[model samples]
Target: MNGETLQLEIKDNIACITLNCPETLNALSMRSLIDFHASLKQVIASHEVRALLITGTGRGFSSGVDLTAPRPGLNPDDPDELLRDYFAPTYQLLKDLRIPTVAAVNGVCAGAGVSLALSCDIVLAARSAYFVQAFVNLGLVPDTGASWLVTQAVGSARATGLMLLGEKLAAETAADWGLIWKCVDDDKLMQEASAIVNKLAVGPTTTYSLIKRLMRDAKNNSLRDQILLENECQSLARKTEDNAEARKAFAEKRKPVYNGR
Candidate 1:
């Protein structure tokens, strides 16, 4: 499904969802978030889609929620109401996707935008791109799980500094701090992200999903618990057709051809 605010296209087992409102730096207007959820539903229902990639068409990935334009039902004055009604559903939907996800940050990523970027399984940003934790500047705290995400990625010290200072973090610095997977040149952002998504789309889909689940829960798991979870996941992964093909290809000295079983 296509909408004025967001665009969705699926091909070659990869589902690409682009934020289309470049006018506001791909701001998450209520209309855009609604379209985003619809697109996500379509992606989730598609058995043929193996991987998902998110990006925006403009000089910024997303500047976060549009402060100037409030939706008819959402109340910006009430942060709890805004989070419950608008942000939580979309964030939970994206987080719950049982597929590999990559967020290709083309330019500026700030406020809730930073949370969106970190929500993905992997994040690749253009070297020229920057992340801003501008919530404090607006006398607000981070929402959309940004506090947990940033703290998990860079530890509480850095997260606290970032949340309090609200400084602009360069993409390179972000990568160095383990905030993103990598930093590429501005011109190569799409190319690199496409290559990564394409590779994941054709790989062992079951294993990738399990990996996502495992890692997502790792913070709450002890080593003993994680080992048990890994063992359980391995048993499930071994039953997939892709795993059999991978074994057969190894025996035959050939590249594995996965059908995303």
Candidate 2:
């Protein structure tokens, strides 16, 4: 499926969403956000999709929101309504997806684009790709969950520095700081991402969903509560058909072929 600013394609149970506005470095205009939300809904409704990959075309993942684009019904000075109405819902949907998500960041990722990449379950960036919190440069603060995402990945000190300084962070440095999952050669970015996503697509879907929930809730939960949550998730995972297949395969000394049950 294709939208005005985005393209969605599903092959082999993997759904790929590409930001297609390369002319503006794939900037997220209002239209793009609307299309993104719609595409996510389509992914959710399509039971065939087991994994999702997000990336951009041309030289950048995204240059963040299209500041140059005209906002018809929004205040020119304030972006409050624009973010709440257009950006937040799409971001929330991405975060709440049951399937695994991978981000292939090819080039510049700035402002809300940084947040978008970080929202994925795994973020793999090209060697040449760089991230920047450009909000400070524009005299604005980080939005689209940038503040929370960055701080969660790195600690408060580094997040503060990155956001306040608004400096370019190389993909390697980002990986070193644990801000992203990995950094690959520029030419291998998509290849590496696809390999991981393909593995996830065929793996135990229920277990993966449970893992995502556990990790997402871990930081907020106390140790006792976290353990209880893990116990609950493990109980659910143990009941899945994939778990039984895995056990049978182990006993037979063969690799398990999961049906994503």
* Predicted structure with the largest TM-score when compared to the true one: 2
Q: Candidate 1, overall lDDT?
A: 0.91
Q: State each model's C-alpha RMSD to the native.
A: 1.3, 1.2
Of candidate 1, the 10-residue stretch with the lowest lDDT total is: 74-83
Cα lDDT tens digits for candidate 1, 1-261: 579898899998999999988989998877887888889999999988999999999899999878876577766587576667768898889988888999999998999899998989999999999999999999998888999999999999999999999999999999999999999999999999999999999999888989988998799999999999999999999999999999999999999999888
lDDT of 2 by residue, 19-91 (tens): 9999999999888998899999999999899999999999999999899876777776785888998899889
Q: What shift in Å separates residue 240 of candidate 1 from its native position after superposition?
A: 1.1
Give each model's whole-structure lDDT.
0.91, 0.95
Which has the greatest lDDT? 2
Question: What lDDT score is found at residue 217 in candidate 2?
Answer: 100
Error of model 2, residue 250, in angstroms: 0.8
lDDT, model 2:
0.95
